[model samples]
Target: MNKRLLSTSFLAIVACLLWATPFAAIKIGLKYTTPLNFAGIRFFISGLLILPFIPKFKAKLRGLSSKSWKLIIQVALLQTTFLYGLFYTGIDYLPGALGAMLIGAQPLFAAILAHLMMKNDKMTWTKISAILLGMLGVCIISLGRADFVLTTTIPLGVGILILNNIVGSMGNVIVARDTQEIPPRILASFSMILGGIMLILVSIPLEQPNWTIHPSEYYFALGWLAIVSAMAITIWFGLLGRKGVKVSNLNTWKFIIPIFGACISWLILPNESPDFISILGMLVIAFSLLMLNYFNKKRIKQ
Candidate 1:
């Protein structure tokens, strides 16, 4: 039992690590294309990337029930379309490190939603305290930005990311609740395809359509984003369906994302650098994760 627990937790960490790369990758890709256009192409390709991995894929699609299909649509709409719509838009306006830090706020929203939606996932004081500390890290990092200003774009980007977290958390809970009938890969694939198509269609009227061919850097970023989305989202969905895995606990692994993402952004993005405040915020976030884990282990033992 402990072995299974450790394996699932490890896989969850792996998924978070993959997720960490997208902030910098997306920032790189956005330089060549518009937000919705870039996001649509990335996700559409990611959905396609998953098809080769599934065994007997044709038969599996043919066998899906209406409920499964509905769940897929719901998740695709919320998680992929709306979530990434806001994500791309927000990340476009903010620095990569700030964007990653804002996204690291997901566990707080996920914990609250899971508490309300799942009886088995009720909140504990330790969990609440830990989430609050993580949020503190987010605030610290944001406030520490050299370009920190009360500009329209700054607040708008922050608001969009907050909404993204809510929508993402809701999608996570829905998948956790109704994933019994569908395989995780199939759910992730169809939803991402449908959502990506929707975004592409919407982008035609909302944003300027791109026609020119791009350089190798654009393709590299896009390819990396798609590959990570396919692997990470599939892994995350699988973990969401695993028995005895709490949504809040699984999402807590995401704390590592901001740390890696901020560091990567500082290293790769010419405009980004690590400040003492940002590093301190990351340390606080790491300490909160440790506290959460210690409390969780104690709960399990009890």
Candidate 2:
């Protein structure tokens, strides 16, 4: 049990770290193309990248059940299409710091939804407290990086991001609950491809994107983003399908994303640097994870 816990935790951190590095890459890619268009291309390549790794991909694709296909389509729509669509729109209305902060709140929403939706994932006081602590850490980190100014659009952005979190949580719970028979890679591959196509179709009418050649930098960013999506998302889906994994507890690790993201920004972006508050926020997040794990182990022992 302990070994499984440690292994899952390690993979969770890895997945979150991969997720953390992509913000800058997305920003870089956006410089060369529209948001939905770039995202569509990135995810399409991500799905294709995974295809080569699965043994007998053609047979597996043909063998998937109608229920599996339905699950895949549902996940594709909620997780990738709606989630990213709202994500880009929300970010447009807020500062990057505020956007990151809101995005970081996903785990909180996940926890609450899991408690309501899954009998085994009921919310305990310790769990709630720990998640709240992580949220506080997210806020501290965001505030440290930039000023939070209130504008008229703030409410709209916050609402959209809240919806984004809820939709994403719904997708996570569905996978954890309903995808035991499906291989992780298959689920991720099909969902991302379908979702990518859906995004591109919508982008054509709305974004009016020009199909033009992009610079090497843009391709580099797109490649990295696709690779990250393919690897990290597969790891995540695997984790979700593992026995004894709770959607809420698994999602708590996402708190590290903003911390790692801040560190990455400081390293790569000239305008960014580590500050006292950010370090303090990192410490708080570290403590929160400790609290979460401590409580989890105690519960298991009983």
What are the lDDT figures for the candidates, one per model? 0.85, 0.91
User: Which lDDT tens digits does candidate 2 get at residues 1-302?
Assistant: 57765599999999999999887788888888899988888888999999999988888888899999999999999988998888888888898789888999999899999988888888889999999999999999888877678899999998999999999999999999888988899999988999999998999999999788888989899999999999999999999999999999999999999888888888988988888999999999999999999989998999
Judged by lDDT, which candidate is best?
2
Regions of candidate 2 where Cα sits further than 4 Å from its true position: 1-6
- Mind sharing the TM-score for model 2? 0.96
Top TM-score model: 2
Clashing pairs for model 2 are none
What tens-digit string does per-residue lDDT give for candidate 1 at 127-194? 99998898788667666764544556777888889999999999999989887679888998988999
> How far in Å is the alpha carbon of 23 misplaced in model 1?
3.1
